[model samples]
Target: MTGSPVTTENVDPLAGVRAPGDPACDVYLTGTVFLDIIFTGLDSAPVRGTESWARGMGSSPGGVANMATALARLGLRTSLAAAFGDDKYGEYCWETLERGEGIDLSLSRTVPGWHSPVTVSMAYEGERTMVSHGHEAPVSEALPGPPPARSCVASLRAGAPQEWIAAAARAGSRVFADTGWDDTGAWDLAALPDLAHCEAFLPNAAEAMRYTRTDNPRAAARALTEIVPLAVVTMGAEGAYAADGRTGETAEVPAILVEALDTTGAGDVFVAGFVTGTLAGWPLGDRLALAGLTAALSVQEFGGSLSAPGWDEVAAWWRRVRDLTPADGRLAASLDRYGFLSGLLPEPAHPWPRRRAVPTLGFRALP
Candidate 1:
């Protein structure tokens, strides 16, 4: 089903702190965007030679677009710099982000000959497998530099550092980084030179443990603080934990229980939530809670960018739980933990219609 356009009446979490010279953008990021086609409701992964039919499917912008859309949905002014191919897929993704999600693409460019990258993701039994294809854009298409912003979120690669990360940090932007899997099996902390400039480093349980040589994810978080001021380790179902090297503070929040439909881009949503709370100067525990809450909400839907919840969803969730009688001690504890959202949420209003990814890129208009 088609969804309504995102409402522009979002409550800015940073309204109270704005000043004349503050950056126009709240977050800046540079990366690649992909046209993601996701299939769900599968009983098992695709067999080697057997045909499998999925009960559900959707299409939307993926990769860096996932994070950008997440931030924008949360009311942050997000800026993305990337290369989009001059193809139908590219056109669709551009409009989806620039108009649909209200993300700024001033630093992005359209390559004449390149085609948009594509990924086919299949979800089954709470796990997903993906296959992707695309040619790299020419080095000449790289972003000239990052714009001034309150913060930047970057996906860090082990040995290949983006000069823009350092540039953004030098421009007084607080950088938060998350890393992909280490394909080379090095897991060497020294390989990530860009971590030196980051204000925070977020990695999953496996990545953190491997990089820090620690047996426990929490220990890995503490070990990483020696490299960055703040380290957050995300344990999928267990929730997330954080350690602050500077303040000697730590916080852990349990994951909100939900049946996940598709896990695509859930991690990106988590980072976006954490960045939102940090920019708003919320407490450490509050930041972790917001991150986990947003991620939890995203997994209950399909696709990535489109599944990210806006302020209206957060408010709806708060109201729902508060109005319900505590069915269990866990439910009551969750309410108490997220109580801070009562003041931060916008005034009650009609909930915005949720957006979902579509199976097709185009449809005919009624005559």
Candidate 2:
């Protein structure tokens, strides 16, 4: 209702890249949506069995919905593509978003006999673990594909349908997709190859190693080049690396020096920040550092969007680091790579549909 666009596709993430260009939507998420029910003190030292502990009640939209909502708050013309039921939660979701300024909801499809998906989050001390459940519904909402938006960043997890993918590519937009696999015990990594046509393919280093079956991050990143010229692999703490033809490079983004309270959706924050910098014409390493900083701030709070940092906040933090010149190797390196760089190529080769499998989230050592 805030004017943010919305789309819903039945994405079987394991389907290996659903087809390029999904009507040029900004982002597509295919995953189990959850409510993110959390207990503030759950992670704290627990008393014997179930002792009476103090906590707060919170019910908010989560997953890709949560990510898009957060980005909208940062003043972006973001569109969300997902599914929900024609139930009470669905109404609340719509109402809550409507009240929030800076988002559009025209793309939200209300499916009959379906319940809005949710995740119960138990946030006690510093960690949040999610027990997620998805509502089963028919894919009957025949909404038309969206035309190319400003910049498309699609995260294929578990909710979108296959047809939408083809529609997205047809829109002719700057596309980037993160990996999301719906391995409900059925191992299929179809999204990997399908995202090949995107401008950037960002998968965690661990997932790339396992899914691509490669040991080196550079090789894995470059390998993704065949699918899309610029492929990136993010290494938590170590930094993020990218490869594209004779332009292969890696930069270490320094992690924020904050005691992380919760890491749920930290990855999503990183993606949003990175993409924001990219669309703003910032250098890659700077973009990565900005992403890491945003993610670091996210873990210091609870919930998904509730913990996100606005642009001003991020800029302030970056200025502090720059002025202080703290000796953090990773962040310093990222700045060096991205700082004062100009007149770079405007675009990398478009990604061909992926030909390999999308790996599950995990970790991989760098070469």
lDDT (0 to 1) per candidate = 0.90, 0.58
Candidate 1 residue lDDT tens string, 234-344: 999999999999999999999999889999999999999999999999999999999999999899888988689888788877777777677745556677899998887
Cα displacement (Å) at residue 47, model 1:
1.7
Alpha-carbon lDDT of model 2:
0.58
Candidate 1 has a TM-score of: 0.95
Candidate 1: segments with Cα more than 4 A from true spot: 1-8, 347-355, 365-367
RMSD of 1: 3.8
TM-score of each: 0.95, 0.72
Candidate 2 residue-wise lDDT, 1-367, digit = tens? 5853321111111123234743333443333345555455453645667774535434566666667765654455666555666777776656555455244556657677788777777665565656777756565765446545756667655434355555666656666678755476332345344564467778888776655668977677777676675677887766677675536655555455667656767788888877766666655677776677677767766666556655445444444444444476545543443343222212212221111111111125488
**Best candidate according to TM-score:** 1
